[model samples]
Target chain A: MAVQEAKRANRLKSGKLVNKLVNEYWEDLINAKKTGKKVVYTTGLPIGPFMAAQDMAWIHGEGYGARVAARHEEKEPQTFAENKGFNRELCSYARTQMGCAMFAELGVPDDLNPGPIATEIPAPDAIVTCYPGCSTGPQWDWAIERVFGKKIPWFNVVIPYHMGRNGSTYMKGEEFEENVKYVVRQFEDLIKFLEVVSGKPYNWDKFQELMGVTKKVGKLRMEAMELCKAKPAPASFFDWSIQIAPVNYLTAWPGTVEAMQAVKDEVQERLDNGVSAVPNEKYRIFWEGIMNWNKLGWMADKFASYDATVVAGRYTHMAFWHEPDTIDPEHPLRGIAINHLECQLNLGYPITEERMMTLSKDYSIDGIVFHGARTCRSFSRSHFLLAENLNKKMGIQSTSFEGDMVDDSFYKEELVNTRIEALIESLEAQKSRG
Target chain B: MTSKSDRSSFYTMGVDSGSLTGKAVIIDGNRQIVSHSVKQLGFVSQKAVMMAIDDALEKAGLALEDITYTVSTGYGRKRLEIAGKNLTEISCHAKGANYLYPEVKTVIDIGGQDSKVIAVDPSGNVKNFAMNDKCAAGTGQFLEVLARALDVELTEIGALSLQSDADIKISSMCTTFAESEVISLVAEGHTTVDILSGMHKAISGRMKGLVGRVGMQQPVMMTGGGAKNIGLVKALEKTLGVSIFIPDEPQIIGALGAALFANDFATGIRKKVEEEQDLDKSRVPAKDCASCSVQNFQLNKN
Candidate 1:
């Protein structure tokens, strides 16, 4: 009973609130679709603020896949796609959403009825592809078109890859400034496309208000992040990740700001009292990549067993730390341009290496855990190299374990358990000698 | 181990309840192996563990209470209530390999359920390691699956694969695909020796990749049951471009490591007594590691 009470005290209320907000947002979309309102499909980039300002529901690709998996309704769509000859080795998020698309369009069998993301997410009236040259967003858009038997209205804003050491390192330079101008021009095209689909002109005033909200959330989130630098961090990265739900799904909304503020307050209280989320926090670890969402509790418990807490990570804090570019207040699209391009997913190394080293020092991390989430190639590919760099530079050791974001079978619990236990044991030995 | 005068004799038992087999080793006070036993692990892990322990005790001429300490390891380490401590197979394998071949900086262990490569520093501490238990590829189960596909006993495969003259390329990384390819090779009139050699090459190539992940070091030692397979060892040496050192009783390495740990714990010479893992099923009081300081990362003002 006491343990249950402690868990409840440690838990954040924003998760329930975010779930409510998501359901209501989806219900609003379902109702809007009935009234002939268009839904804009997106690749779940940094386009949430823009979509919300246009009053078009964002049926984000990866977000929908996560939703289908979180709700355990992925089997129907995943099987449907495999039967239709889609390669199983493709990214899991892609496979799941494709399954969701085919299942939603054609029909689900009697025994395979799934929840909203799989069955009720209506066909996209338009697609907004935004992965620059780093990935293959165009290929996915073409596949979606092939599956749906129609060419949806396509609006793409190519986020420029970082020619410098950082993704947004050259934002202040003339070349990157011109690149931002080019992307801002494409945003103008997206605005025109939205104007055609929603049958309404661009609303600059509403977008300005949304950007103001974005600024507010960023402030609150960074404040909470600062609190995590405390010794024996007030909250684990797992807790921070749960709090990021509102920021990722309902970005630019007033509710998101409130959720973030509440999280900041809760974290501040823990910091003021010098209270750790885990009872006997020993090692401060920088978790470098995405966790297996389904095994979050299992992994957290294992870390607790080792008396370690993940202090900070890219996956948990990326959405929160996205401070919009210092562009003119009149040009809101330029801020979106900066947000889309500055993301770690859209960038390569050299920059990430520096950021990880700094955060490792700031968090006073003793070790690291880089998960190979099989579904995300963008995150998994650079892990070993990044880990090697950190080890050579900072003496911060890292170990890799394979897992999937939502697919439970792909995640071998024993394998992960043994590997992690071995890592922790090794760290303990090293620390003992040091 | 520290000095001649301080050295005293004590007995300890270590049991490794592996997935496919159970191994037990008893060490005297001089840290010499007195007796050991290896048995196939049947359905019940606890029974198999006790049977192996009894076999070792008979050879050592000792009863249960005669041993000073007992440690358990391997896949079923947690199940044996007779032991007061348990360690992961990684630590045990490293310890065992280090004891036998101290010059070895790397240990590649291919057990029944999983495989791993441990890179050890000069101090006999693991510097880095990589493991693969996600799939049957490059594991003992992979060999067993192929053995069944070829209608051959597992014990004979090592000898059979060495007689082949020409190398047959087997490109499938998936076990199921590999099995089907093996069947087709047999149907196409390929000799069992050649097919077996191809399978050994495939397994070694996969293991070589795992070893390379931890940055393969020289003087590599091979432990676990897989090291007994001559064909696989040759293939691994060929793939890794270096010969490996294998212990006499390759399968009992984990058990031997546990016994060494048990002796050290009893003598209070090595790791301080602490509640490490899920042992002490008697629900004994937890003892935190004394050498460990539970605190934040101290500011390194370099």
Candidate 2:
């Protein structure tokens, strides 16, 4: 059979992809129901599924979507209502994710969207949660229960953190295979639950085809990262990082492999041409913290003009690193689980720091710039001390900049520019003296 | 062997067991350094201290019996059993700063895992201080990571940052994000010089934030291993709009402070011992004196 027909036939057998597509298609159907029109919901990290559901829901008018996030305050609020029922000791990412969920259920006014938006978004008619190990996970479960009551459909995907980071002791060189198997099992369970809830037979062949396509796409994506390992790959860490969205969202879909194949071809062409991602290459810097979501273009342009390049960052690497080289048919679900768990943000601080140091050494960074986000205490909490230590111990120059990833108002370009100018002069002087 | 008074009057030893390195300083009473040694800390703190002490003694042309008193400071100050007294790193740093430049009012010490901004009175007393010990963002470790990211030697960071012609503003405060930003910039074809400059700016900004909290006072003295980075020093001066004074051998300030304390302690001990001897002589009874004389005669006869 031709690749397309083979994919179609395979999708028909698995039923997972068909189930997701039907779920998305069912958003419109659910919105048509008077009782389910104003749906509200909450979600956790590896937010691609939730986002996809939201996008689909918006198309179907299954009610407008709003993501709940946590705010950082010096003092914990006195009451549960005031505190939003969150643990102050938890990381900011967990706090925010949980806080958003809490606010949604309690009908608190949020800056993301004032008043009530949707009681629940329908794309994810049922949640397929992986782990409740992090503080955010349990709170997220509680928040969902509080908001939707017991009426909402949910499935748990038990992801042991030890298995994710430490790899499986039960298997060597087959850890990824084991992890993927677990994911496939969860996917199957999710499909079964959806069929029962929707009262429709999921097309198994389409699902298998989708999974097959995803497997192929996963392979190609790994190839893309490997391509970067080449001497003259035509990409930066940022390029590779941003490209992860399609890989994550479109995975297990028929179109993913083709899309990734095209990207790989382009990357190969660039590599053949011996083209570097950044042409000017004036000064190379290492970045820390979350990217400014709104001003990435602006920031990139500003730095590019100065002939300065950002060599590495946590966000970009999270997407590119730790990809499996080949797919395991026997353990497809396990692969998905490993992919989700291995993200940079999901790892603990010690591991993150070790990776950062390794990247710094590997990249030959001149200096480090730490972005201390106002909102993300999880990522920004100890950055100042990290910078100080780097400077003192390694004889490297380190500095911190304050701003939020999503919020643009916190960034003052004029103040930032002045500081940059002075810093450059200082660097120049040091070079001359040396 | 030298008499206790002679030993006390002649020499003193200072040990500073910093987080990353250990230093030992041997000085004569008259402000002349007999010898000094530095060693990077291994897993064992005591071993590092012993090695440093042995090396300093070997270099100083002195024996252990010749040393009167030893003062210790830095993170491992309390672990030094051979030292007579332990002083806080802050106090020792200030003393060292004063010894190098008596006019310095502000002292900045950047260590491996922490950075401190210290304000000193004319008498070298610490008046106020601010410290960032919670993260490695503005510390030496950040630089080490950046150096690795750039594939450059740690010592080359300062020189490279200084060579940049244009300023690259790295806006990430988190080390992870900052590294990502660097990678992105490199992909976009940014020059290493600009990136280095951006990094220097970032460090300067963090230092300025801490310095601003303490209020910048002149003459500012930059100490610690971080002070070796001229780019950082210049960046700090620019950020604070003030000149920074870097003394010779900036890393030795803490040990220098310990040495000064040792000198004072040794002198005080000598005075106390002399006073005790005088008291003992005064309290001598007549019968005891006769008996002592007889014993001395017998000893002489023997």
Candidate 3:
């Protein structure tokens, strides 16, 4: 868990504020154990606001897995899970968090330390498993409880897939309302479950206030991401990936709203001053999959070296921005269910493809980099088709490479390097012709 | 030959250090090839690359210092200390094939340990490309492994495949699985020619997938060491439904392309120097970095 600062130039100074915010968030998690605050581990959903409302500490499994990968410490834990007969094909993030639980049982091996960021992953008082997008993530929650071998209280919610109803852009009409009602009923059960765990009555009024704050945070984050639409993008997709921690993990934290505002102001100032994230940016790229957490910095510098900037990624831009303006404070749970069901990952391919096309035009993308995550089939599947559709529909050339989100062994640096170089060569040729 | 004393005479060099071979080409100011050489690579690819350059230098009656610029290409291009710049073999292969066969729209390069399909424009610019993953299923290395397994000499397998009397098919494109299948076929009293032909067909099948990724275009050219295999060429022709084009020396195409890039880079440098010499030296001018080869050098380090 040794965090190395990236050596790239023109990094946003405001990124430090978010990093500080994340560090404090982790500190709060550690202090939760000592303060007798009920700690809950959950899959990514809109449940963080509710947890905050209930005065509980939330640890998102996927967020911690990304942190593990960013520190280049996924190997020992991933291997630990694989050695115990878990298939390597399972989601790397799931395996990584699972391995952390195993380490809790049989202490971390010698020559390895959990380090500052990974230290003291408190046992969950309750588990809320929400399958917003990922099919493999629901199993992760059940597996974690078994790993601990504890009689832990847990609730699971599965949202129906987001295909457009009545020919709308996404889910709509009575069908969408029914889906929301189903998830709302599940959320009510979850609220009851949380009330028993914390020994307190559910506060709908406080929850409504937190949901409003969450909407503000999402709006600020989305506006900051949209600033990259400038000709000389003030931030690269890699920058957004690093800065995504607050929105992804700390959305309900106290300073998260202020932290997001600071980021938005900084990006706006850069856009005004014409300060590009990658100097001498020539080609703008739209990244089309999960960030290779282990190679985040390396890949950023690689693209920058070719005078190409990865301006935006759907994962970073859409993770927090689930139509912030549409969240109804009066009916917060229904709003949450609708957003979760209609999130980018849960949407049908045609809808996703349409979104990417619109973004490609809005961002003036020259090409796309489709990273096929080795362990995450949900994101990796149909990438070739998507790239082809973009090329045919928008005349945008693309390159595809195989990699894993958390597993470093699944990536071949040289292979990806060659692919990117070839892409730049094509871009250069096109520019020259014009 | 142009004398070394002539300042206007520019000689550019290119070295391509591949997985199994090293190639070098020297071109004169008029962009005509002066001399070219290829050497079998050893454990030290850098040394083999240097040897290839030395052989080309000796043939051209020139010294290394006489060359104005050098650009390296291929997998081991980065390891060459002498290269002023390095480019990926994908771009170099496309450029080389386009230069060799201007009508070629697609270039399928099967090298030592990998295969790639590149789509090129009429102007020798790469439009798109596709490469095999981290597997050696359809490459010279795979052929060598199977050659060793069949107890047949590598050079003779292509001709032996051409003489096959029975049509055969190898189901697996995985190198290890195909080798096992070859062993099983040998035990079943299958002829070596038929087995080699089947292996060639299997390789062609894998190549078809790569070609399909970047949609195939007519007037295709084949390059690299694998292109020397007549059996693979014929099998690929049948699989792709097109007549293939082959250079006289396919393995050195990447080196030729690197040499061409060196010539272009040298021309740009010369033009910049003349422009700078004509301007006011006292005034600091805005640097035009877009066309500079040094930018490519910086990119290579990353």
Candidate 4:
């Protein structure tokens, strides 16, 4: 009953509100003097399963007071004096992350107000990182040392490339078991360290309960996958993706089972009614790059007249299935670790190709669409090859469109529409041959 | 000409002495050894060539005398005094990617000064390649400059980007504008972590634009030092929506491929010599130098 109340309370917290609170919690930690609490800092990508896993791990394990610093999302305001001396031809990720670090180091208050930055989170006591899968992860660690004038102890969990695939490679019974075993071992060690630091007993029962929730959530996810396969496809890939967030964030929490149950029951009921999540299937194209500021409807409406449904996409299913099923309760952190390693962004190109092919084949996709986002190279690097190969290999027509995830200027409707039209025609011709 | 019997077991070397680095590959008839030694290019290219050759021989556990033939490549190829032949970097990279992964059809190499997108056949032959050597946008130099501006080491960029929480906007595409933007952000009190994330996104975005032009193929391997950057790899994956393969040692792919070519070229030469010997009895002595009838004959046949 208490859990239900907690879930209800959580439900009332909108994403924006939660983000604000998280921001405030960080601010409090940054301002507060050392309370002898051990704070471990970890980095994350913005959109992948690993990010959710890290969030859950921190929230559940250390609470909101934990000094969690994302590599860089903060923008430092530029003064006219400094602007004159800055170079114009630098990579943007470096600029942003470095800017944020400088901002934090100066102890400058938020430029918006005359007070300290909202999130004055203190320097991390220790750093946990995944290796060089992304440029920002390593760079941020360097920035921390440069700005803070100290080197934090760093530990890493290596994610192999084999975990990104779907079939025998990733879901192999023994391999999955071994993966779980490895993660559990790591978690046990982490717990021991935490126990020593906190001067408290590790909550074995809490961990077990969390594992149970994870198993339930995993089962519910399978059901959701089935729902995705439902005749006519139950909902928009965008909607389905959003609905799965709770399952991702709360996987190891007590609320997860109920959240998964609620989501599953809701989806199942919709499936039974033969109702579609998004009634209009305009131009069903695969979306690339995190959906433009969650403005999926913008893209959906663009192809609405053409009956596009966005049958499959990297931002949706590609990111979702990247995580393995969490069945074992003994080592909960292992499941989180797997989720971290299995993120689409973390796996290098070979595994990405395999996953793209799998999603295309499984979803009966019509065409491959790539977003030539201006801000990201990791996701943009080999899209052209992927598109060309998919066309030749799978007979699925493909096209690359230009757009930024945040900046609207990069998204040109006319240019994108023309390309989309050509792609659709090509896909239609291929479909006719079948 | 080297006799077929004597050259059958002779080792050959291919030195791809590039602007940013030097590579030497030694082929011992049946096996190949690739040794890559990276150093700054000096006024004279011979020093670079010698260094690369020595490195290759050391790696192969063979002496310099064991190498019977040498092929050189890259911009400095012509300057290598010991080279028997010079090849282009494009051919060498294609050959390298094909040698490492026989199934690879496309090679995306992000080198220090330039980025190249190559399309090749399964047999390691280059079909077509588009290069962005003129610009720094999609090359490793772009990242290096960004690293300096951010005050972070180049090696740590990839691991650091994994920490990004927000998608900080990088308004500039030009390297100069981008650097200033980073500095301004620093003055404004933004975290260095966010700026670096933005820089990676920008570079990935530029590379995506380049990759979009050639079209991608499966089993695509990333070559060059930039491949070492984990953050860029992830950014590329996010942008392309496909996974990229990084071999055990990504930086050595070009050298390895060049070495494989040495083996193939030596074998081809031996075969050619044998074929010539067999045709010696039927050889014609005289031919017109200025006006050859072969062109007319070929045209007539077509």
Spell out the clash pairs found in candidate 1: B10-B29
Q: What is the interface RMSD of candidate 3, in Å?
A: 8.0
Cα shift from native, residue A318, model 4 (Å): 4.2
Off by over 4 Å in 2: A1-124, A131-134, A137-150, A162-208, A222-233, A271-279, A320-322, A348-354, A361-364, A380-397, A409-434, B1-302
TM-score of candidate 3 versus the correct structure, residues matched by position: 0.89
Ranking by lDDT, best first? 3, 1, 2, 4
Docking class of 4: incorrect
Per-residue lDDT of model 1, residues A22-88, tens digit only: 7776787667678766777777465666677777777767667777776787767777777788776
Sorted on DockQ, highest at the top, how do the candidates line up?
Answer: 3, 1, 4, 2
Best by lDDT: 3
**1 or 2, greater by DockQ:** 1
DockQ of 4: 0.03
Which tens-of-lDDT digit does each residue in B1-302 have in candidate 2? 23655553588988988767788888887656778887876532667778888999999888888888898876676578888877656667877898778899999988665577877767666554556524467777677777788888878788878888787898985677788988888888998777878888998888887886556788999998889988888888888889888877887788888898788788788778888776665553445575464432211222
Docking class of 3: acceptable
Task: Locate the minimum summed-lDDT window of 10 residues in model 4 chain A.
Answer: A1-10
Residue-level lDDT tens digits of model 4 in B107-146: 8888765577776677676544555523356567777778
Model 3, position A193, has a per-residue lDDT of 87
**Could you tell me which 10 consecutive residues in candidate 2 chain A have the lowest summed lDDT?**
A1-10
Model 2 residue B132 distance off true place after TM-score fit, in angstroms:
7.1
